[model samples]
Target: MWSLALLFGLVVCTLSVPTGRNSPAFAIEETAEWIRYEGYVAETHNVVTHDGYILEVHRIPYGRFQTASTAKRPVVFLMHGLMAASNCYILLGPQNSLAYNYADAGFDVWLGNARGNKLSRRHEELDPDNQKRDFFDFSFEEIGKYDVAQMIDYVLEYTGSEQLHYVGHSQGGTAFLVLASSLPEYNAKFASVNLLAGVGYQNYFPSLPLRTLARLTNTIYASAVALGLVEVAAPSFFRRGDDDSIINAVPEDEYLSELSTITELLRDGADDSDNSNMFGGAALKQIAHFGQNIRDKTFRRWDYGLLENRRVYGSVSPPVYDLSLITSNVTMHYTVSDVLLDERDVLAMVNDLPNARARKVAREDFSHLDFVAALDAKELLTDYIIESTVQIENLRSTGK
Candidate 1:
């Protein structure tokens, strides 16, 4: 799910992509409203980052059968991946959706939407549509650093909860790592963390077209910067513009169609074919950040070139995230068939963190999207995570 295909699909599919492969998918009417329609209690909380971006986080305070409470149950904060909104959690309905299941299991569920997505696009200062260049200048560094940090602080303060149980999929997981590693103080804020197809350590990306697209995006971004057109959407860059520097390089290989996962990819939480809110939007800088990781094979901060890097980071290059700083217990679950994030990449990330481990998805044929959208995800993955969280809570309660 954390590939250039998804970046393009999320950033362009709904706007200017051709009809067949990269077309837009169905978007949910409203996340909270949809949850309420399903006989569940839903709440919306708007959190402002330190940098002025406002994020919309959804909450399922209790189960359909249980009463809503002020006393506070165990809190589970579920964050979505790149180009996805918090709605991805409940898209499969109450039965298969992880958010609904967690709520049903007596846990307070908080759904987080990253900045640049539809639900969280508002900011205190710059208007996204009016000031496109400045509004879109940030990358995931700001996300993991300012956005995730403020959101976590807000969630804890709002619920009066001391700690949270975190579950981050793809870029969400990367955000967690960014927060934990960069700001180690936040590590103890999470009781447990589960990363589904954890998207850091991209040294072993398996998809060729995805790799090609990453390079192409990087090239286009550089060219755009040189041409004073910094904020680029995939539609503008991928289209056959007269500037052939980045145009004629679109991957048209026959096997490229085999990577039809783009069809399932979400943009603005609407790509689910059977009435879903799984797709979401992203910024061009966010896409380029991941693309840089794909090309350089380093999970470092976004590169700002030599002069700007020294000015912004006080170094010649971006510093790598120190995984060793993440002292909280983290379990990374990877599906064997995930085309974008290889198992080895997940394992390598696991090896870096002192308190991290890797768990392969039980389903052999599980793809990247299956971690969230699979029909049997509860049985295959979330069930185990829920059970594990239960055991952890029980141990804490018993002081064992």
Candidate 2:
């Protein structure tokens, strides 16, 4: 009976549910509730970028266990991976969440939502619904140049700090590399950077499914655009499974039953309320850009085809991002089981960095999603993050 139910649920998710815009509007409210439930104070702030996109940044000023002496703590900025928002860090709930762990350790934790995600979908001059192309014309290049830069500046100015510790996962790490390579002036702004399951070079990908999908990305994106759908959404299994906001949007009993069925296959110890909300929305161009990286095996800017490349870049080929420009003290964390990023690719990325250290997860079976959703993630990764931050702080104080 259980096996039949699980199979049925998988079939339903695979066929019926569409990705992207299926989430509810109460994401912010649910986020607030999750933070407070875990004994942390949550503050939501809107950041307006120079390019006119409005982003939502969440802050945990202090934790319940914090003391008055730790009032003005060192700031730590945490950015999520592809198709994820600030919710990724808090989805595991307070006890196991990285954001809460940072706050408990006396660091002012700020979660950034990149442009076009659920939280940062508004623009100054263009409406997302009315001006689809203009509103969603960016890839990670723009994210690195505008969103990351503006968020770092806002956090620094708001905290009155000269430098803050940085932590990024996957595309978050990619954006940091892009920022350091393009805007080298920001190198001094980070005390230390910890990249988890990050991607730098795409010369090799381990997942057969991903590789196959990459090959078809251009075709799929073109078809979607022709069909009047410009926004791409990740599959539902890639996100949180227990978000109350999504639950509130559906019939409680039916939602719970479906949730149980879905989790049977993608079990990561998440509760029924923990529905996947990883994918908000991404531009068609952004999807194509990642596909290009996978196909070209080079971490370069978007290819505007040959004709447009000459006009925009003065060459037929897009210029490769110079990884050597990233001089910040950096540490990379990867697991052997991550299907998207192979060990060789990660080693290649680390080899290019001027100042870097590499750490592998102890668990041989620790997969990509495990970094955020595994039951033992706190012990396997979050503890290491806390310890590394302390070490970085010590090094800064001693001027090492």
In candidate 2 the C-alpha lDDT for residue 228 amounts to 51
lDDT of 2 by residue, 1-400 (tens): 1111211111111111112323342343366655666667888889999989999898888876543453578999998776567777876666777888888887899999889877888999989878877788888888888998999999999999999999888778888989999999999999989888877688876755556556665565555455455544433323343553223122322333344433444332223433434345556566567777877788999887798899999999999989888899888899988866778888887898899888899999997777776658899999988988988787877988
The count of backbone overlaps in candidate 1 is: 11
Q: Poorest 10 consecutive residues of model 2 by lDDT?
A: 8-17
For candidate 2, list the clashing residue pairs, or say none: 239-276, 240-275, 240-276, 240-277, 241-274, 241-275, 241-276, 242-273, 242-274, 242-275
Report every candidate's CA lDDT: 0.74, 0.72
Clashing pairs counted in every model: 11, 10
Tens-place lDDT per residue, model 1, 171-194, is 888889989999999998999999
Candidate 1 vs. true structure, TM-score: 0.84
Which ten residues in a row are the worst by lDDT in model 1? 10-19
- Model 2: lDDT equals 0.72
Any idea what lDDT model 1 has? Answer: 0.74
